[model samples]
Target: MNNVKGKLIIIGGAVDKGSFTEVSFDQNVANNLNFFETGIMKRIISESKHGEQSRLEIITTASVIPREVGPEYIKAFAYLNAHNVGVLYIEKREQAHDPEVLERLRNADVVMFTGGDQLRLTSILGGTEFHDILLDKFKNEDFIYAGTSAGAAAASNNMIYQGSSSEALLKGEVKITSGLGLIQDVIIDTHFVQRGRIGRLFQTVVGNPRTIGIGLGEDTGLLITGNGRMEAIGSGLVIIVDGRQIKDTNLTQVELGKPISINNLVVHVMSMYDTYDLHTHQMEIRNSQYSIPLMAEQDSDDADPKVSADDRE
Candidate 1:
């Protein structure tokens, strides 16, 4: 992970695919900006080794309506002049072993997963040869792994499968399982602010305090590259919940249906252009003229609280 050559673009649900259904909003105010205009997909292309010529593959294994979802992405990429893109509807585990499928994946520069049920993605593709190839490429090559919604949720090492937003505060209400292991020591949750799922993330981090929780708002995403450096993208917010400083928690002592309690949980609200270092637990806010450094722990009483441009690397 220290020398990771690949990149991850984890997007929240409701990304604009050129349909223009509705303009993006921030804090309930219409921004009239879409993902296309915001340059999210364009960033994906630019980050790739081949730029627009990169062979992009869309995996719709998580989607129930792959036919509908797949075409929309194709059009979206086409609108960006990326014509080499294709969709792979791998609905069963058997399809994951197909030689042709593996070959196409091996040749692809970017492989993106579409939104649906996160469990479906883990169940069908967890131990397949296809999964192995993707993992190897991501670790060794200059690959780009992008995902949206359910796809984004399953990109981390841990995934939340069954959890109701309204009842997430109670013990055993938020369910978690092993994910694709694309990223370690982190958990991703999508459609965060719009669905009011911060409580779910809170419970998860409380249970596993070492893990970092990311709540990505709709139309928003994190562009993670090179040793856990994440940059917020799109129009909405990205919430980072850090439980490393937690002093106490009643989660283990609570009953299954009882609400849990935790003390000293730290949270940082990030917007577009904000950067966070997962390794060092440092944050840099770009919206303001000064760079606000939210460090995990102060080195000394006189340590500068501001993050300089050199500290970002």
Candidate 2:
């Protein structure tokens, strides 16, 4: 994982661009309205090798409304003074092989995937030469791959395609499929908190205990580095569901519509600036005045352990 040369900015749905209205659950609507207006886009540009001067290609393959979505992003980037941006409306599978499209992808320093249907994204571009080029650039260069909503969900090796939040706990309610395979060992879900999708992730992790479940809230995202370091960004919460400690599960034994049970599933709630180490399965909270590293075990007698922030420095 550390050998990966690219960066991934996986965002939850409805990233604020100062134009659209977003539904809020436990978050302040006013705060979320401006949360990612500049923060997320700025971070995306700064993380790229050439910053704002980098050639950005916005792939609208997942969206049915590419005309509207593409222009919105172009305007959004222009607001941040990023001028070298273009949109690729690859709606068909054969379009993915277009020489012009291939050249644009090859020359781009950053590629942004817009929100739409995840299945459309995988079905059209999964096994094409275009996908091969994308995988190559990501593995060999300092390329940045950023996505929002459905785009974020498809970034993982495994994806949840069909599942309702309310019934996700029932056996067979959550459907899983192979995704773009840009990142591995984890399943990503977007619009998580606001949509009450925690059950969806819980079911996924319960069945695939080896894969971690990342539930991203609206306007929030994770800045994942090559070394497996994930930094929570934006204004809302990011939930990490770890099932490694599970002692048992009844998912396989239950019927299709039956409710399943699992034991010892661990969860971590994170906000902006918090960091989670994918390799270590540890988390460091930054909002607290002192850095509290949550580990599997700690010698401290307190139920919740604490350590001086300076100690980590």
Candidate 3:
């Protein structure tokens, strides 16, 4: 999807989906657990305490059904619950379309997509009634949605969700596919630096210089404003590749199965409070995110980190 006005919170992977919100519900499904708490967890935890409905929700179609991930996203819940927010899970979206899922998504203030596989996220939800609902929901300011790993990748115009996080952009390795239609100005990649995904993200932008590429590190996310400007949130960095300035050579001849050579590709790093203009391609240093101050105002209550919190290990 091109540009729709909504928020995108991209994570490294494995954000706790259930406990983050303050709402209560009977468990109807389950999924595996993995990944850690990027600093965003702390923010959500503090917010849920006031019992004021915060804007955010999570969708884990990427890890849906037997691979359910609701139980796995506790840190995310701890953060959301701290704010008295609500979190919901949706499984069985693989071959089924449930309208209630969309209803819940529309009702929630923030919508989150958990990590797993970008293909799964898109293949299951794209074009479905629920997917349309998400698209439609973006038109409303009350909604702010986030995703991680595959989820983060799926929020872009194009997604590279499959494959191990190997840095080398080998031929036939950078598999690209359609995403949730949230942010279409760029192609999104996750587990960025750790996974060595820059080469692939760079390659995509080179092919289509008109398109920008964003590589978000594990536990790292980009806080994009409604105006299309952005800030880096979390402990890690979000990489932005700008191919617009490049006067490139020879990539059309690059064939599959054989590694391709890439020339100079402009890359930028976005860390906490960094501002990036999606349209003007301008990068700035901001005092804080216009809305939420990342890590700066963390009231930081003493709480044990999740059991698998160090997923990067």
Error of 1 at 113 (Å): 0.4
What order do candidates take by TM-score, descending? 2, 1, 3
- Model 1 Cα lDDT, one tens digit per residue, 1-313: 5677889999887644222222322322122225676677888898898989999999998887777667667777877889899999899999999999999999999998977889999999998999899888989899999998888999999999989999999999999998998899899999898889999999999988999999999888899996889999988899999999999989889889899888999999999999999999999888676644556234454456596658855
lDDT of 3: 0.62
Best model per lDDT: 1
TM-score of each: 0.87, 0.87, 0.74
| Residue range 185-284, candidate 2, lDDT tens digits | 9999998887899999999999888899999998789999899999998888899999999999988898899998999999999999899999999999
Q: What lDDT, from 0 to 1, does candidate 2 have?
A: 0.85
Ranking by lDDT: 1, 2, 3
- By lDDT, is 1 or 2 better? 1
Over 4 Å off, model 1? 15-33, 289-313
Q: What is the clash tally of candidate 3?
A: 31
Q: Please say which candidate is ahead in lDDT: 1 or 3.
A: 1
Per-model CA lDDT versus the true structure: 0.86, 0.85, 0.62
